[model samples]
Target chain A: MIDVQNITKRYGHHTAIDQVTFSVAKGEVLAFLGPNGAGKTTTMRILTCFMPATEGSARVAGFDCTEQPLEVKRQIGYLPETPPVYQELTVTEYLTFVGRLRGITGPKLSSALDQSIGRLELGSVRHRLIGNLSRGYRQRVGLAQALLHDPPVLILDEPTVGLDPKQIIEIRELIRSLAGSHSVILSTHILPEATAVCQRVVIINKGHIVAEDTPEQLSARLRQSEKVSITLKTCPPDCEMKLRAIPGILNVLPGQAGGSFLIECELGRDLRDEIARVAVLSQWGLLELRTVSMTLEDVFLRLTRHEDHLSEPAEATVSASAERTDA
Target chain B: MTPVQAVIAKELRGYFVSPIVYVVGAVFLLIFGLLSYLYVGFAGAQAIQLMQMQGGMAQINLNDLVFRNLFASMRIVLVIILPILTMRLFAEERKLRTFEFLMTSPIRITDIVVGKFVSVFLIYLGLVALTTLVPTVLMLFSDFDWNPIWTGYLGMVLLGALFLSVGVFASALTENQIVAAFVSFGMLLTIWLIAGLGNLFGDTTAGRIISYFSYMEHYDRLLRGLIDTSDLVYFGSGLALMLFLTHRVVESTRWK
Candidate 1:
């Protein structure tokens, strides 16, 4: 479990994270999505107690990060961007050392080391020095070190950044298997990776959380309402213009169906019945009719760019609604 | 393993695997051998000096064979060897970025500093112990006073300990081994000069205070089979101060 509130990191005049606030529930896998320089790593560092936040407070496992750092660190495992590896040590030696540092000992330490090596699939390179291991193997070693103590939370920063596709898939599968047992907060700019492993995504841009929701909920929230896109098989020449002239019809734009139209209507108005009446009277067959929707990517860009309300009829009517409210 | 034991074992293994440790030991042995037997001509000079004496060789005075060789050997060997041993103690770790892994681990800062210092100190001890054969060889051929040799060996080990501690502190302050070596040599040189610089004064209390600070002046008395408590305190205090400073430096790294 983690709670970060009003967290802002400023280095001199540059702000890395701007008043970001988010929390993760127990055993939940929360993916932090952001573009480059979007402060994803900075936030992860704050959560892991690797770096103090410039402003605000963060708590991990109910322990304050700044005030109770050691306790917070004791409760969470961190795989930094660079992995924090000792190249001269063997995989078993490295994990054993890490386990000892984390207060594991004797049979517990050995068993933990064995489990980590087994889980991360690092058994082949257990006796080989880390310097001779490939990038993927070294990465698994890093992950194993973090998991050796079996901490309840894992804070991984770009865990699969430089790995090949197969390695990435393997690492992802490993992370996916940690779902119910460990609470994870991973930051990555890779959209599909987050979608695959995370139940909820937090899209951040310019040091702020632009949107946070399930993928489907985010997509649904960005869809336009009371607007239907209609494609006609055979329509009159001025069908789109005619649709625009109908009462309660706000706007009509020609679409790609040769004689299709995208129609917007007044609030709480569904003109599908009226449009069907007009289409039948005009002897024009409706081939397909559906509402226009936005994908998660569109919602991500719109919210991050601060343009979410710009094209919404709700926004227009709010000026119109504010004007209406004022009237 | 406990953090302290884990750190100590890792540091010792690092020393065992590193080529620099052996190279330093070989060079130290070579210099000790050259200065003791060939340059000073320990065997030939003694044979000639004994033959030239009118007192029927004075039975090859045991004191000269044991005391003279160890005293002379230490001045040359320790001065050259300690800097090489301590130079990379912390500097190499920093340059390799392996220190970051150690620092960030849950181990205490004191454990790391003490572990590294002990490993390097052990290397110094091993190198010093290897040269004991010079005295052992002399004992086989002549009547030698073992007391002075023991005293001299103790003083040299203590001297090495003191120098290594200062070098450890210097190494912790920088990532460049060259810089650490030079800084340690400079500090050692300053300690070596303190008594002579004291002589420049008109024998005031200030002058005595300055003279008492020189490790070599006390080391010389200790080499002559006399163990002054003041000298013991001087070297002991100096080593303690450096170890403390090394701990501070190691701790300060976390803040950075």
Candidate 2:
């Protein structure tokens, strides 16, 4: 539903985004992962028809951003970084105004407002002034404003930046539930958010796409060390010390579960046999043991590091696989 | 509602909710009342003197003595107060970053510019309408010609509309409301002063053309109850020119 072909945006001597190219398919959620100043917002701005690129073209819902901006804007529900809300207006009033601006009126506009308010859980605060709401509520109001029109395309920039943990999880679930019908391209610096709600991750750094793949592939490709997670029935006093003393063991870290340990070892070593032997000989019953995968955090750090970063931008679309980050 | 009408309605609702319009409206009505009181007092005393000196019957023109001067003084107030009403229209949108929301929406630049212009113009028209209470209350006491007073109001409306268009244009030029107010104030003052420059040139054709450019000559004709086509054209063209300039400034945001 969206395609950007080699668009470059420049401001005088400074190039904001240099020859950037990406696309989001219908019913797919693409995570635009990058640190601050990685040109994420700039790219979204061009796609939303808010501004034109200095070179190349961006099309949304098959309408050219520059030439048919009205048509392009008609098909987008954009939640900018700031939420674009009026502090003085009530939630319903603001949404009504937005609905009218989008050409939704009468019964259709009210139904859309109810759906957005219900989905974002803005029912209680629908009549309250936005200025009286908290930061998280205000953020939800922003999200609700974007979803009010129910457009095919959703471009949200840092949608969960200011929400609490519970709100963040709820927002992620809401985004996850929007997987089949809406084509979403959300930009964020949070690594786990990408892995949690998005099927594909596109890591950008300093205006360049360093890596683009399914979260697991990017993690597996960047995985340089082997990690083993073991849960035991009873822990010994010198268990960590003994695990560190084992040859080729890179590091020892505490696991998430009770009486559990995460052991890192050299890439090619079979640490499972050695770990099970220690558990058997030391009379510690092994309850669970499994090799842990590298996280999106590791992939993010590995790709963003300039010393060995990809000079050529990663090409094509990424698909499949989902993993949770334990970090 | 259409997009333009939606913008106008939203903006008009916003004006009433905010404190700016209440303050500007109160100040406007107060000044109009006080000035009318002073003019009526002076005109009444002169009429009394003329009647007494001419055996209880004399011709004292209230149109010249009261209203023409009243509108002349009232327009200077419009130039000051109308900008305050319009200063925040575009400036606040830019400051609050809602300009992005508006620009990215499926509306044309003309919709925003015209919507904002009409919204503030309506409020200005309402304020100008309130001042009619002054004339209506005076009519309760004695009879006077309402023709010039009505024309004088027509003049006030056109003058306020012109000032508001300039304010909208100024608001588009910057993100600061105070700066917008003062920039428009400076522009309106310059246009008013251009009439003085016309005086310096006397009766030359250049003088007439330069003087015609100012709102003074056109508004004066209307004050005398003379509804000339040239004056209407002048106000219409001036209003359009300013709004067009506002449109250009708003449209230029995409390139930047």
**lDDT per model vs. reference:** 0.78, 0.87
Docking class of 1: acceptable
Instruction: Name the candidate that leads on TM-score.
Output: 2
DockQ each candidate and list the results: 0.32, 0.76
Query: Per-residue lDDT for A58-102 in model 1, tens only?
Result: 998899988876788788888877776777678888787788777
Query: Under the 3 Å rule for N, CA and C atoms, how many clashes does model 2 have?
Result: 0
- Return the clash pairs for model 1, or none: A317-A320, A317-A321, A318-A321, A318-A322
Chain A TM-scores for all candidates read 0.76, 0.82
Candidate 2 Cα outliers beyond 4 Å, as residue runs: A228-270, A278-292, A307-327
lDDT per residue (tens digit) for residues B1-256 in model 2: 7888899888988999899999999999899889888998998898888888887767777778888888999878988888899999999998988888898888889988999999999999888888889888878877779998898998889888899999999999999999999999999999999999999999999999999999999999999998899988999999999999999999888788
Number of the predicted model whose lDDT against the real structure is largest: 2
Give the Cα-based TM-score of candidate 2 against the true structure: 0.90
Question: For model 1, what is the error of residue A206's alpha carbon versus the real structure, in angstroms, after optimal superposition?
Answer: 5.2
